[model samples]
Target: MNNKRRVTVILAMAAIAPLTFTACAGGGAAPASGGDVKSLTVLDSYNNDPDKGILQASIDKCAAKVGVTIERTTVPGKDRMQTVLQRSSSKTLPDVLMLDNPEVKDVAATGALSPLSDYKVDMSAFAGNSLDAVTQDGQVYGLPLPADTLGLFYNADVLAAAGITPPKTWDELKAAAAKLTTGDQYGLAFSAAATYEGAWQFLPFMWTNGGDETKLDSPEVKGALQLYVDLVQSGSASKSVINWNQADVKDQFVAGKAAMMINGPWQIPALAKVPGVKWNTVQIPVNKPGQTPTAPLGGMVWTVPRTGDKAKQAKAAEFVACTGTEDSQMALGKARNTVPTQNGLHQKYVSEVPTMAAFTKQVEDARSRTGKLGKDWPKAATTIYTAVQLALTGGASVDEAFSKAAAG
Candidate 1:
């Protein structure tokens, strides 16, 4: 699975040698003359199987269409930035690079990426948040292939047996979860681990309650944290959430130990394997009746690196463009279990896969994790998850957790 990174570009310039390129065309590196470049080298973090194979199929299709062979390198998700930095310093950066959306701003800030507009890549189809994820200082550095966001995944059989509809508000969710609790199964499952994954899970609750990442110690934010603390304290959620990641939450749900879980579409493939475990998805519940369910956008984007060869870079851009087309998006989405980022294609996608309707609706209200904070987001995300872990583990009260975490 491709885990998203909340990027913080605190690297020294000496570590990743600065590209001495002039920003001649709309803040993008002008493609230099390197005649008849016949092949493209690419870098990405889709080393895991199924995703690796699935992504390569799209690359192969685009490479064949562009009449060029592709030389690709795959790295582990957590190591992708380090790989890029090392490659940048050595001047061995690939012709095309794939970056988690938040990482795009950090990399683009270093002038190592060429703006897609320079190659005339289509910019018409992306949604506002999708476009926002890959843009920095008014220049688009990358194009998202698609987007994913958190949702409430529940056991349809469990909810039906309990005579409960999917929750629409926090109060109802609490009641439903309490009602569903029995034996080893908890009312709900979620990840509150001290990592980016935990922060990703918390965003919907915090943002829906009007909590701003910039104001980490505010009452709105503390109230959201209280909800998690309450869940665990009331035995509706396991105290083990302080250590579980999204995958673990999904496991609990599939094993009949959790009636509901907070996760994203990426879990669809795994959930589908167990035919007996009937499941359905709904938008994450709101804190109150009229509030929208806001979630953090998840996924990576394709970018063209400043390889000092305009011809190869432009051709690479064409391949990047190919990957974002509606057909290409849907193909990869179905194969990898993600939602399309294009505004118009979302309806088409949901109509074809009815299970994704709630996810598609939630994406409209979703914001990029780094949208407001930019490269500094990783710092804030770390604090957010630290507080989540602190509160859930009873290491500190909700207010104390946020205050102490933010203090550091």
Candidate 2:
């Protein structure tokens, strides 16, 4: 699997704290006229095969359309922001930059990125939350590409043999999980590690239960935490969850130790390699019938940096726009196992890739983690995971977990 596509929330949030940059004042390359541009520099975190190649194809297609060669740089996801900061200070920022959506606001706040609006980039086809991911202070900072969200991945064979259907509500989930549990196998598996990955895994349950991140100690949030506690206490979920990451959870599922897991489409390639698994996905269940399952949107956004070259910036903007087009989105979505961020393409995308139907549906109501709290999102994420840890480990009761974690 490509590590770049699986960046944890902690690394992303940590990189933002020291990203102060002076947009156009850096002393490196002189401004070049629009006519002088013949090639554009691009930087992104798709540094492995498959994803690297998949993204390159899209970049190449866009490069051809814009009539310019692309000078690209691929970094590991965790190093992406640091690279940007280093390049920005040295006035060598790439003309086109790809940012993990959650990091967009912090980077934009530093004046390191050019507003796509200034180039008249058409963003009408994108999802509202996708746009919100890159929007800061009324200005659109970047264009989002294909996105992903959490889903309930089940071993079809296990569920069928157990006479179970995919769960749709909290009560159903608990019942199904308990019924599926057997000797040395957990009915449900999810990450509860003390990291942003854990917080992300918890979001669907929290948000669907009407829990707000800003008010962590509220009844709604406690209800969500209690669900986690109940599962572990009942042995429906393993106590090891508090130590496992998403990748670990997937491994457990693949080994048949877990019947279902909370994960994303990025795992599709890995799952495909294990033909014996026979897995399928569904939207994460809501707390009740009327509530919506709101998972956090996961993907990167392309931006034009203030590289002090009008021609290169214009060409880069064109390339960025090209990548977000319906055709480009469809191509990337199919090759990358991601859902297109463009509106009106979900059904069409689903028609083409049936396995992605559930995820596509989830993206419709999914939100950006930074949408509500922006830079402060990391703090909330930390609180969430801490509460989960406390409750699951018996350090605190469900009713006191969030409040205690918040207080600390």
- Among all candidates shown, the one with the greatest TM-score: 2
TM-score of 2: 0.91
Clashing pairs in 2: none
The estimated TM-scores of all candidates read 0.90, 0.91
Candidate 1 residues 179-284, lDDT tens each? 8889999999999988899998999999999999999989989989988988889999998998999999999999999999999998887898999999999999
Minimum summed lDDT over a 10-residue window in model 1 is located at 1-10
lDDT of each: 0.88, 0.91
Which residue runs of candidate 1 sit more than 4 Å off their true CA positions?
1-33
